[model samples]
Target: MTTVQSARGPLDTADLGRVLMHEHVFVLTPDSQRQWSDEWDEEEQVANAIVKLNELAAQGISTIADPTVDGLGRDVARIARIQAEVDLNIIVATGVYTYCDVPNFFAFRGPGIIPGLDDPMVDFFVRDLEEGVRGTAVRAAFLKCAIDHHGLTPGVERVLRAEAAAHLRTGAPIMVHTHPGTQTGLEVMRVLGEEGVAFERVILAHSGDSTDAEHLGSLAEAGFLLGMDRFGIDATLDFESRVAIVVELCRRGFSGQMVLAQDAACYIDWIDPMFKGALPNWNYLHVLGDVVPALLERGVTESQVDEMLVGNPRRYFGG
Candidate 1:
């Protein structure tokens, strides 16, 4: 049986039912929080996360593939604590999350910086997938990297290449936080393709931010899973447009090539908590309560919904 690692332990991939391809229990700037913030309360935050995730599980979401890694402030031990209180399967990932440069931790070591040295990120990522993350038993189930509008700087390229190398070593599928507005997915195709990583195993996240159907179709046809996530974040692209694009793609027979998510998190330290009120539906249950209803009302069949929410994610993880 093919199994995938979750925050709790290894579970049969078949058990990873109704997955939200992208979601986070928490997204923190640990350094900033430690030094400059007094709002963070470990006990309260952990309890809040359990309450929110339990609500998601009660909504029938069996798994949430969280891509919170190094740059996003991953804490596997803390995640395991939250997992112990919830019955949901949380699939964590390994890879750096940076748009412009590698973190200073990698600045002088690896590759071009040191003439004869290798990229240590590849080994770290592989170890996270093959063994565990941060000395904890929760092994990462997939690889994640980012290439935003800043494009591929030396640091960005290093992270992407390291992610590809890790994928090649562990067969863990990849998820790239792409900036589709600038068509950065094209860069991902070129780079990962050269690394011998199959496009079918890559997820071009935030593809829903772009309403260019032709561009989306081309990428889907090229075998990359389009993440029509960020459902409730209407600030980038409103709800109507996001739903319309998905309906159109399903009408064009691309449901098999897409995955759905809110990209929501219980707590994100980037934004002011008061500002979060502006995005009321930007939570885990928005997909089930709002998006699915909107899709069906707009003529998306139940089978197409299943393909995006269930089958596509399963296939992504080799279930």
Candidate 2:
């Protein structure tokens, strides 16, 4: 049986039931927070995360694929701490997160920047997938990167190429944060396809944000897994529209090509606390409490929901 790495340890893929394919334990910019934010209380935050995750577990979600990697402020040890107090499987990831440029750590180095150098991120990503992240036993089970409305800039291309290289070496699946409004998923297919990465193994995250079923269906036809993730963030598309798209896709017979999630986090330092209040339903429980019922009411079958919530993720992880 294939095994997937969890925050606590390795688990057989069969055990990853009803997974939220995208979620984060925490989203922080440690440098910025240290310099200017006082909203963070480490002990309290960790306890709060424990409460949140356990509550999710009680709702019958067996696992969550957290894409909080380097650019998103991933802390493996902190995840391990949270996992210790919760039974839910937390599958973490590796790779950078940026819409335009690679992080400055990668800026001056790497292949084209220097005459004889190789890109270091590929090695780092593969190491996380095969070995362990930062010497911790919490190995990354997948690779993550992003291309946004900014399109594929030099740095975005670098990160995608590196993630593709790592996927080639380790057979790990990939998840890309794409801006569907700009149809950037096509660029991902062209680039990663060039690297010989399998389309089925890559997830086009935030696919639900765009209600164009034809645009989404084309990607599914190309064999890429569609992440109907980002359920709670209604600022982009409202709740009814989000549920409607999934119903239409399921009707069109692409249920096996999709996965679901809220893209929620226990705490995110990106938004101002005052502004965060406007998104009352943007939390970890949105999918279980709201989206699923809506999908059912819209005539999405139980089997289709199971495919998106369970079987698809199992296959994505090589179950």
Candidate 3:
């Protein structure tokens, strides 16, 4: 079995104080430096992340969980550096991302004609969790997976199976990325249930995109953590719409089952080119500092914010 440890040493979740459940420190596209164009560089990326972390710490955020899975260029060593520099608890994740984003090898030949919960790949996840990620002293505290917007693709389904097996072997919580406004969360929960995984050990990401109260309420009632992150992506839906879904969920007494984040990163060219004239817009901390406080002003209670930002994440990450 894979036994995971916190990267920031031992932590008391009760004193986790305030936390940001999902955010990325450094994110790189597949083509490496070439993919980033003129605005991307390692040093600049790290510096921007540090500034954001400091800003979040000042705003009462004591911990952060960066769910940058394997295909996402999750740099645990750099994360460790940021943690030490900022003195904020940062938790890193280990596991494969969505099949589309993963390398061709993972999607093609492997165990069970897909990335099954068997053999070498399973060994890979187990080793990373038991030892450390990429030979760094840092370790992963959670496992991350993703389901496509339309539901589980063949590649995605295989990844899910691998995740399930990893969960059974490691006892690490699984965080799943689902499509916005889709019923993918339910499908993910169904698969996990079939694999004999407990709902409490899984977090349904992007649950906020779906405003279906009954669906979200059902997931909460089923004992799963609902992640309503993606706070800064205004292109798809505005913050108010997303906050409304969360507020409605809170009203339905599902506050304790929710986790919040602004899944923003410092990929300069990835965002709309018009913003900052192609410079990296790693200003998610600004959103947390502004939007979350706005939610408070609009009657989202401090206790509710605490549940979404702090308490729920501690429980979800099994801190």
RMSD of each: 1.0, 1.0, 3.2
Clashing pairs in 3: none
The TM-score, computed over Cα atoms with residue i paired to residue i, of candidate 2 is 0.98
The clash number for model 3 is 0
Number of colliding residue pairs in each model: 0, 0, 0
The list of candidate 3 runs beyond 4 A from truth reads 1-4, 30-32, 99-102, 107-109, 112-119, 275-282, 286-288
TM-score of each: 0.98, 0.98, 0.88
Q: Write the per-residue lDDT of candidate 1 for residues 30-56, one digit (tens) a residue.
A: 999999988889999999999999999
* Ten contiguous residues with the weakest lDDT in model 2: 109-118
Candidate 1 has its poorest 10 consecutive residues by lDDT at 109-118
| lDDT ranking of the models | 2, 1, 3
Deviation (Å) of 58 in candidate 2: 0.3
- How many collisions between residues are there in candidate 1? 0
Q: State the TM-score for model 1.
A: 0.98
